[model samples]
Target: MHTSPLITIQAITKSFKGVKAVDNLTLSVGYNEYVALLGPNGAGKTTLVEMIEGLQKPDSGSITIQGKTWQKDAAFLRTIMGISLQETKFTDKMTVSEVLDLFGSFYKLGKKVTRQILQTIRLEEKAKAYVVTLSGGQRQKLALGVAMLNNPQLLLLDEPTTGLDPNARREIWDILMQLKKERGTSMILTTHYMEEAAYLCDRIVIIDKGKILADDTLATLLTSYDPGEVIAFQVSSPLATNSLYEIRGVKDVHWIEEGVKGMLTVESITHTLPVLLNLVESSGNTITSFESRKKTLDDLFRTMTGRSLHE
Candidate 1:
């Protein structure tokens, strides 16, 4: 592996009918590192990855793999880059092993390597299984395995766990981490799940509407928000939520449990405690339980965007 960034995208912009889908986007993935490209729908992440994969060309700027432009050396880049898209299409009649063999043929994978990949992906038993008979998770693993058939230097995965159950998701994460440790493959992945991004990504890049909103280590970006504390209480009465919102220094009050319960985020817990106590006194809203905690990424995103990431 090169002792440098595996991929470099410099001010890349792609347009569709004069509308820029990827707006002057600049990103890089270093050798043996993993990064997450996270954004809501229409964030231009997929378009950007497509450009890097040479499925499309940028209107401006450049994409390079190990200092060689994708335009100049598409075949060489293809040898080093492995991509697993949001969806994988295979011949319905192909068995797991047969399908893998097809990809291996293209990449010229050795028998020893193909055998290892099957085992690495836990598809050894599914070798005789037809691709169409596999579950969503199984097919996903197969898709990933096919992508890695070349023993790629870089892996790009787009929403690899979108339709997986919790167990399957965790299983995929284990496999990915294994690949990271054993192969030292640089990776760039796109996903909408913040929790997944937090756990898998060495660095997270948050984007929206073709522009970057935040990009850094999760902890570093989270610290950019206010250091406010929060205490969520279950209100015993209907009027409590709005009453708490009226308290001083309370920026936003959310009725997380509807009228009977809520979470209030405030400036300073010490100063806000008296305000909350006073509100409880005047509104006669009983508190059944309470919890206090520091600011979090979810809250920070909500504060800035006026909507949760899921929203």
Candidate 2:
């Protein structure tokens, strides 16, 4: 059995000043799926998102939201979609509640959802604080509250926690996770942080130069693009680099320093870890620290695009 996607983008193309921001890109989001859209600065992430949001028109292509076209059903589109951009500036004097009320007024729905949204975003305590007085994370939370005023089915978030501190970012992530769990909102998040994508999204869509480079679940992407585990360790004494390579299941070894620490990409940790430990111990060297993890989306992006996601 197959079901139609909740949102579909077909061969969308957009350009600015002879530069193709989005070059015949197409994608789809399933119902209640959290997808992360990732790309470098010039990769057209913002352009593509705007086109889907109906803020920018594509030169050529079709965007359908729940089988509704923006051209024919713009009002309906507004009612069902919530967008939180990287930065949203409100009147400095307006309080959090005031800002949410102003955005809520745009829709026919009244103040019923405001309290719920405030509670969801954990801004109930600071509801009376002016927008200018709120911390960066709180302001971001208010922005999310405003976006959710219509109780949208589709949520488009653009770098929702770009500059926030670790604690604030975690707070935002927690709020978003709770919302997804409770409302099942289909969300498309655009972020440079690979950890954010891995933590929140069911699938990852990597784009480069206006085209999708890869799209798959985080596990699938890791397995398909970077199928291996990296074991990194620091030793009290140096072991010969060639000796490390001779360990079972070690496909490759990269020394961070000739005599201090190094990393190994292995085919099977079960086969390699014990052998590695034994080798280090037998060679009169003690491992000061050891850790291992499979390759991540960050590695996949670098492999495919030869550039950092933040570039």
Candidate 3:
């Protein structure tokens, strides 16, 4: 509900040689908002983040963090912002405490990263352990702790939970939620995990091929762009595709054949299930199994981008 913009990208365009990487991209993150930058590989997400981080300059446009542009306030911005990249490689010889101390020293007015920060990241017990001895999840938590050592107002997290096990990922999510609640820290997250974005983000900005595909809250996006449910069923015999198309209120019907059995996807489950079942029964076909689910981020992504997230 905070209306003040904490981060803004205005008319941003970045190119490599002759090809555009980010085309006229305009995005903003409000104070205390959690926004996700979602896209597939080669979708200009990295390029856009790099521009915001000031690691790469855009071909044309402007980026401001907390009403200050990088060119005019690079040093001051570093104090107010924290960035955690996808992969952080720390010295194997350093203990967790040593790593935190090292990062904390870089800021002029950085908060003293104490045992509480370690406990917050759930790494207090591992404080004395060497960096190389930590598991992937622990290392990631430590990296997050380092990013937050300065007690930044804006946190930029890039794929924070990628490559983590479910339990480990959930731990990170809990920590993030705790931070959001306790500190009201604004965050801009870049991730491919749809469920993570849905659960953690207030708004999702979907980018593809250097363009913004959709920018809105998940509920709004799903309800407006993708409505209804998908009912799937397995049959003992191949379903008559022609008869499926005749079901009243059915938006679309698709099926897959596996030897003598088949699976179908019907868009209108509530309106078509009863009629479709009767029609299949009358046609001498038996349904072996059935399931139905509301349309999710996967379906919406495929609908917009013409491919799955992995592709």
Candidate 4:
């Protein structure tokens, strides 16, 4: 038997002031799949999300959720979709429970559902706390709780943990992971944090200038687009950058500090490292610092786009 994807976007294009924000993009999300939409600022990630969320209409092509178009099935679609934007504001005077209760009422949900959502978001203790008194992370959890009230099958989170500290961010991740494990929720997350996307999403789609540059599992993207171990080292003295490329398995060399500090993308560190060290020693340049690690999504993004995710 064959099953359709949870959401389908077909060659959708959107423009603003004669500038295309999303240029003939096509994408899909499967049932229970968690996808991360990663790109730099003005990359049209938000624009694409807005169209999916029914907040914007594309100039051309179509978007369908569970094979239903937003133009015709919006009423039914709204019931199955949950959205947590980059920032959600609550009345400062409203308690956490009250906030959830208010949103839940829109769906005609009962107190029982509110209790469960509070527990699911790990904010039961803060149920009585006012929104103004809650921490930034707690507020985000509340926003997530509100989004989850409908028991939505699809979740859309836009930079949900952008400003939180590491500990706070992990808390959000834990809650999201729980949702995926327990309820099999499909999700589309837009974020600037490579680690967050790497940790949470099963598939990553990197978009730039309203176009998808790379889309695949993290490991596959690394291996297919730019495969190699990264060797970053600092030397005691300058050396010819071109000479490093002569080593076997060395694919690319980037000089962070001209000839003194450099990084190498090599097919095999075992083959390249020894030769690199010998060359440096023979050239009378002592190694000051060295690190070798597997190439990461951040490295892949830089290779494809020539810019960092945050940039």
Q: How many clashes in candidate 2? A: 0
Q: Rank the candidates by lDDT, best first.
A: 4, 2, 3, 1
lDDT of 4 by residue, 1-311 (tens): 22989999999999999889999999999998999999998999999998999999999989989889888999999999999887788999999999999999999999999999999889989999999999888898888899899999999998899888998899889988988999999999999998998899999999999999988998788888888899999999898978998998998888889899988999999989999999999998899999999998877877887666766
TM-score, per-candidate, Cα-based: 0.87, 0.83, 0.89, 0.95
Model 4 TM-score is 0.95
lDDT of each: 0.81, 0.86, 0.82, 0.91
Candidate 3, residue 11: how far the Cα is off, in Å = 2.1
Candidate 2 lDDT, tens digit per residue, 196-236? 99899999999988999999998889897778888889999
Model 3, span 129-176: residue lDDT tens: 999999988988888887788888988888888889999899888988
Q: What does the lDDT read for residue 86 in candidate 3? A: 74
**Ranking by TM-score, best first?**
4, 3, 1, 2
lDDT of 4: 0.91
Q: Between prediction 2 and prediction 4, which has the larger lDDT?
A: 4
Model 2 CA RMSD to the hidden true structure, in angstroms:
3.6
Candidate that would win on TM-score: 4
Q: Encode model 1's per-residue lDDT on 126-238: one tens digit a residue.
A: 99888889999999999889888888888889888887899888888888888789998888889978778888888888776667777788888777655577777776777
